[model samples]
Target: MSNIEYQFSEDFAREMDKKDPLAGFRNEFLFPQINGNPAIYFCGNSLGLQPKNTKAYIDKELQNWSELAVDGHFEGEDAWMYIRQKSKPALAEIVGAHTHEVVAMNNLTSNLHFLLVSFFQPKGKRNKIICEAGAFPSDQYALESQVKFHGLNPDEVIVELAPRQGEHTLRTEDIINKIEEVGEELALVMMGGIQYYSGQLFDMKSITEAAHKIDAYCGFDLAHAMGNAPLSLHDWNVDFATWCSYKYLNSGPGNISGIFVHERFADNADLPRFAGWWGHDEGQRFLMEKGFIPMHGADGWQVANSNVLALAAHQASLDLFQKAGIKNLRKKSEILTGYLEFLIEQISGESGVLEIITPRSPSERGCQLSLLIHKGGKAVFDSWYGKGVVGDWRNPNVIRLAPTPMYNSFTDVYQFGRILEQSLAEFA
Candidate 1:
């Protein structure tokens, strides 16, 4: 949406909603209530609102378990043993990978640790890792622990790339230059697909190419990018990636996470990984064999059996995603986020109090806009929260608002603007 064309009025928001192709999706989710009224939910980046059909999906699995008992694992079309496979198509579509390249499994941190074991091969003098300076704490801990596990000093082996002085986001050129400067010593290049705080979407394809040119594996932690942004992980040649479903995927809080390994590693059974029975070939799995023959493709990385209930919830959300289509969702997302940005910019005018730290370009961001409050930040956030404006507040001053295309509407953004303006006046 053009800046000049956006207006800060209810009628404008309503008209935009009327024209939105994905507008019906808003009713598919059950919004949280505040004083018997539905909230203006803008926290999908943190935890997406629950889908209405999620209960029915879970109930089916519950019924299966009750009626079939031990037979549940092998019985019916939605068999427990193959439940994870049900999510592959939707997940692959979301992340732009082949079905064989993706799998829903452990939580993000565990999957990160597992993928690091296979990808972060630090040998000889080429034993350095590169990542963003202020990555999410879990990622920081995972990298540090992994480096230590390999008997390397995190300080010397893990190279953190920070934004330039007074800058809120990293430049792609600087990232490429760092990859070149580190050169032979860089063993791996791992970064968040979209920085959780700033909501800056990195140029993954360019980063992957640069890392490959340096003979280093490149991967991403897509906690914020999985469903919020458009990705082509396979075409970009990313070595591996992992993400949680609780956030944009809306599977449920702290639910299953997914991983994407390039097709190049699909048939490479010799790849080092901590394997379990579930990852073994199904034909030989029940034999209780001594040799671990892993299933081909990303399924080989699974360390345990599928989480049936979680997968059921995940499949419910994925089914919605399949029906709505990622392409269509992304289209609505751009305009919804753009509209939110426009409203925020209008509110911030001459106040110098509310500042958007997220990238201005639509191509460089997803649904999220990170607002850096210069004054009375927490108080303003508290006021908004009290008034039923559901947004995430980062430590110190940032307010992250994600107008998700799956459930949020143009009117939601408009309502948030109204609440924000009142809060700023009373607090800031």
Candidate 2:
């Protein structure tokens, strides 16, 4: 119902809001209600607002624990033995993976290490890992630790592709060329599913293909991308990937995360992996045998007992994704984010003070826009936040506006744009 052909105005946004099919979904979230009014929350790209059903899902598990105790693992309603099983179908849909290819497990960083143990096998001249230069601190740390784990020097073995001088994005050709130039020595390429700071959605399919050309593994950190964008981990032929449920997945703060393993390595008997009892064949798990016979799919990578409460929270959120559908969310996302982009440009015209750092094409980005505030720094951003326009600020001078489709309305974007315009004028 959003008409992108016309210029965005307060009336235009209100009209579109009236016609939005997903408009009603906003109320299903448990936004902070101060004085009985929902706060204007525009931070789903960082942490999604909680679903109304989250407590119910968690309560089911809590009841099982209190009443059934150890028996809950096998006998309670929503049996814990198969609690993880019920989640796989919905998660597979979101990531475009086969049910066997995905598993919900430990937190994001832990899953990253588990996947790396299996796929990041560097040897001989193939000892380098390639990633974007300004990746999230956690990812950079993981890559550095992996390099040291392999007894390699971080500087010599880590290949960080950076943005061009005076530019904010890396062109596709630049990425392809980096793979080609370093493919021989590259052990793996792990990138953000959507670059956190700039909101760039890296072309995972192309990157996977390019990396495989030189027999290198490719993976992604989907902290910013999962649930915000449509993904095809299996179809893309990616070796492995991991994502946090806390961000776009809406599983609450520091919830459990997940991983995907392509079926190709699922049956590979010789694939290198760190083994544990939980990953071993369930039938033989209680036997506690010396030999570790792992499961054949992504479940094989899980190393310990799951945190049931977090998994319950994750299922509560993924249920919303299932009901709305990733493709449908993406459909609405294109309109909502495009509307934001259109309005920001309109308000800041000819000012030379604000520039968008993310790509213009919808395919190249996700729900967030990285605004490079020209004349002001974080102090200016603080002023906007003081006015109840909630957004994130990167270190030096960038304001990230993520108009998440599930909860954000055209009206929220319209208002946020107006606030940005007001702040610029007041500060200037």
lDDT of 2 by residue, 1-428 (tens): 24457455889888988988888888778887534556567788889889999999999889989999999888966777667888899989989999999999988898898788888888899988889989999999998998899898999988888998988987778988999998688889999989999989999999999999999999999999989888999999998989988888889998988999999888775788887777888888888779888887988887887778888899888888888888989998988889888888888887777789999888999898998888767877788777777788888888888888888898888887777788768756
Q: Which stretches of candidate 1 lie over 4 Å from their true place?
A: none
**Candidate 1 lDDT tens digits, 161-193:** 999999999999999999999999999999999
Steric overlap count per candidate: 0, 0
lDDT: worst 10-residue window of model 2: 1-10
Specify the highest-lDDT model's number: 1
Q: Each prediction's Cα RMSD?
A: 1.1, 1.6
lDDT of each: 0.93, 0.86
True-structure Cα RMSD, model 1: 1.1
Error of 2 at 295 (Å): 0.8
On a 0 to 1 TM-score scale, where does candidate 1 land against the true structure?
0.98
